[model samples]
Target: MNENFQAILLNVLPLLAIIVIAYFAMIRPQQKRNQKQNALINNLQKGDRVITVGGIHGTVKSTGAQTITLMVGRNQELTFDKLAIRDKRPS
Candidate 1:
């Protein structure tokens, strides 16, 4: 029983180390990116040029309570959820 428990602990230790490494290498950066994206979306206003999650690029035409209107090109308009905006205007 003692040997079995020791072997299991050895195997679990490496897995736990891998999980920690993965979290720092992959998960942490992704979370930071998500937070930044959320901040950008929350601060959106009219006249801001934005890129959507679906890859559409447009200028914010109007803002509603839960939706936003985007003008993709000349005379082309679209509406999407506020959360779907991926980025704001370039400097």
Candidate 2:
């Protein structure tokens, strides 16, 4: 009985350590990044230059409650979901 308990503890200890490492390595940083991204999206405004995740860069032409119109080219505007925006660029 004691030997069986020892074996189980040894197996569980490694698994717990793996879980801890995974959380620190994968989950925590992702959550922090998401929070920062959300803050950026929420503060978006017209005239802010930004790039999308798809590599499209443009200046914001207008803004709605949850969308922004991006002027990608000459008179070519694209409406994107606020969440689709990636990073802001200084004008």
TM-score of each: 0.72, 0.82
Output the worst ten-in-a-row residue range by lDDT, candidate 1: 82-91
Off by over 4 Å in 2: 1-7
lDDT of each prediction vs. the true structure? 0.91, 0.94
- Candidate 1, residues 11-54, lDDT tens digits: the string is 99999999999999999999999899878877888899999989
Q: Write the per-residue lDDT of candidate 2 for residues 1-91, one digit (tens) a residue.
A: 9999999999999999999999999999999999999999988888999999899999999988888899999999999999889999999
Which stretches of model 1 miss by more than 4 angstroms? 1-9
RMSD of each: 2.8, 1.9
